[model samples]
Target: MARITAGIATSHIPALGAAIDLGKTGEDYWRPAFAGYEWTKQWIGQNPPDVVILVYNDHASAFDMNLIPTFALGCAENFQPADEGWGPRPVPVVEGHPDLAWHLAQSLILDEFDMTIINRMDVDHGLTVPLSLMFGQPQAWPCRVIPLAVNVVTYPPPSGNRCWALGEAIARAVAGFPDDLNVQVWGTGGMSHQLQGPRAGLINREWDNRFLDQLIGESDALRHIPHIEYLRETGSEGIEMVMWLIMRGALGRTTRCLHRHYHVPASNTAVGHIVLEPVS
Candidate 1:
């Protein structure tokens, strides 16, 4: 059986890429910010899991406001980088793990978790930004990816509990795979900040840190946190933290913390990162 060895959570602030590519990571304001991800870069190089199940939300990129599925799994052969208003990033398209993705989708559906399985889709900065930061544009990505996109755009999205349940389902699916492989699941986005009309640069470090601590040791508590409260306190878009609960729930109760980093003011959003290794 394959083992899920590591889990990670990071903010998908697209500006970070712009900052780095423009050679601003060393700027007075951004130097300390980019310094935080150094540990993550080193960890990935050392562990280098075979497959990375990237859990993130689409920012009105692939799925517009028309129709949104709470949880969508990508089982495609390839995914192109999206052209969000400005332009597409200079990077190769992401390749998918169809076999593993299909198996996981089948197992999850069998386990009573309804999923929107996608055969084709273009990935936006929500997914690519993190990949660019974690692993620069190599000739190819270091490992195969199973992109699980959650819908945090439309109103009345899945509850935190629902997201956590999906995580549990994912863990079961990964464990049931027959081949011996190492997998890492990542939940991207959020740590208290909003992007919208007037209330743009909101940051609640207290809530963000507490959310992180709970996710590591007591995620069950997070399932009960109401969405309205997350929006009220962390900001409307910050509700994306619910997605992290999915990654945490997938890891279950036994996980070893490897590295945790947090920063604020990344262009009106708080940036956070965490890495978890399953304890055998």
Candidate 2:
């Protein structure tokens, strides 16, 4: 059976993707941001997964107010990079694990998660930036991807606990798959940032670091943290961190963290990344 191998958490700032595609990594503003992901690329290069279940939110690109699903799972054979009002980034099209993805979607629904299954959609930076961060400039991504879009942009997004529970469901779903596969679940977005109105550019490195500390072990504390607090302290956009809980919960009761990288001022956001695996 396929086994859960890793869970990754990260911040997916749009500017990070733009910087990568425009060859601006060397620029003063971008050097530090890109620097943090260097070890991530090397880490993944040394230990790559056959499939990655990516958890992220679409930034008003694919599903707008007209249609919003609290949780959506990609079951398509492929996904194209989105042009978020600035043209698509020069990245390889994402290949999906339709077989596993369909199983997961069905299982999640059966488990009472009610996930919306998607067969076709263009992936936004929320889904693609993490790919660029860990895979670097690859002609084609090294493995198949499953895009799980959360409704963080819409008001009243899923609660942190709900996200964590969904992760648990995914864990159960993946563990039951009847295939020999290595799968990784990734949670993207957040590290204390507000990108709108007068509060734009707000960042609380203290809270972010503190949050990271608790995330590894005392995640229950992190889960109970109110959404308003995430909005007030981390910034409205920072509430996206709830998505990280999904990644954490998917890694099972115990995990051995392999790598963690955090940096600030990535175009009005803080960048954080970590890799861990379920420990027997």
Candidate 3:
């Protein structure tokens, strides 16, 4: 049976990509930000997976208000980095595992998830930054990526419980696949910081840390946190944290944390990362 080897959650801040593209990783402002990912890079180097099921939201770069599917899965053979008003980052195009992606689409639909099947889509910093942080600037990404874009940008995004349920369904599809492949589901974005409007630069270090602790130790309790609480305490953008529950649910009820890091002020966002392996 195919297996889920690991789960990862991190913030997909666009500035992190700029830091990489401009070679400012060691600069004063970005030094601490980049430091948070150092352990993740080394861990991935040692324990690589065959494919990554990346869960992130598009920032009006790929999907505008006109077309926002609550859940969209990329089945393309490759996805180019989107030019989000600025020129596209100098990142390698992401390769897709079509055969597995197709199987997943079929499985998810039958399982009542109703995911929109995307044949072509441009992935934004939300997808690529995480790749850059975890794998560095490789000419070609080290493994295949299956992009799972969730609609957190919209007002009525999927609820936290709903996202968690989808991840649980995905776990079944992944395990039932006949091929022997190592799969890692990554839920990227958030750790309590908001951008835009009067509340532009809000950072809740205490809330963010408490979230990380609960995410690892008391995830079941974390789910009870309503969307309004995330908006009220974490800022509107901080609501993206619900995506992490998808990764957690995919790992089953028990997991072992392999590596974890949290840092602040990455372009007005608090960055958080955690690596987990199912307690096999």
Candidate 4:
């Protein structure tokens, strides 16, 4: 049966994608940020998974105000990179694992999670930036991807507790699959950032670090964090951090953090990344 081998969490800042596409990674302004992921790139190369269940939020690129599903699972044969204004990022098309995706969709829906099944949709930076961050400019991504787009773009996104529970359901579903596949669940977005309003450039390093600490050592408390605190403390956009709980939950009750990286001022957002595996 398929088993989840690990969980990864990172901030999916779109500018990071542009930096790589435009060859600005070596530039001093972006060098420090990209440098943080150098070890991850090498580490993933050594410990590649058969499939990665990428958890990220759409940024008005795929689903707009007209429609928004709290949890959307991609069951497509493939997903084209979305054209976010300045054309699609010059990256390889995202290949999907349809059989596994459909299985997960059915399992999750039966598990009492209202999952919107997506047969076709273009994935935006929320999904691709993390791939670029980990795999670099490969002609094709090394592993098949299963895009799990969470709804964090709009108001009243699922709570951290709900997201955490969904992750647990996902792990249960994956465990029941008969394939001998190695899987990784990745949750993307947030360290602390607000894009608009009076507190536009808000970022709380201390709070972000505390959240990371809780994520690794005290996830029970982390999962119960309310949305208001995220807004008041981290920023309006900081709510994106709730997505990380899903990855944490899927890793099980306890996990060992193999690696962690945190950097600030990456296009006015905090870039946080961590790799974890369940404690055996």
Q: Model 3: per-residue lDDT, tens digit, 50-95? A: 9999999998987897999999999999999999988999999999
Q: Model 2, residue 137: displacement in angstroms?
A: 1.2
lDDT of each: 0.85, 0.88, 0.90, 0.92
Q: What is the lDDT of residue 121 in candidate 2?
A: 96
In terms of lDDT, which candidate is stronger, 2 or 3? 3
Q: What is the lDDT of residue 275 in candidate 1?
A: 87
lDDT of 4 by residue, 221-271 (tens): 988899999999999999999999999999888888888889989998999
lDDT winner: 4
Question: What are the clash counts of all predictions, listed in order?
Answer: 0, 0, 0, 0
Ranking by lDDT: 4, 3, 2, 1
- Candidate 1 lDDT over 1-280, as tens digits, reads 9878888998888888788667788898887777888888987988898888998999777998777888899999989988888888777789898989999999999999889999999998888878877886576888888899998878887899998888888999999999998988889988788888678788999989988787665337888899899989999889888888788878887677788888878888899988887666
Q: What is the lDDT of residue 120 in candidate 1?
A: 90
TM-score of each: 0.96, 0.97, 0.98, 0.98
Highest-scoring model, TM-score: 4
Model 3 spans > 4 angstroms off: none
Model 4 weakest lDDT span, ten residues long: 211-220
Model 1: residues with Cα > 4 Å off, grouped in runs: none
Superposition TM-score, candidate 3 onto the true structure:
0.98
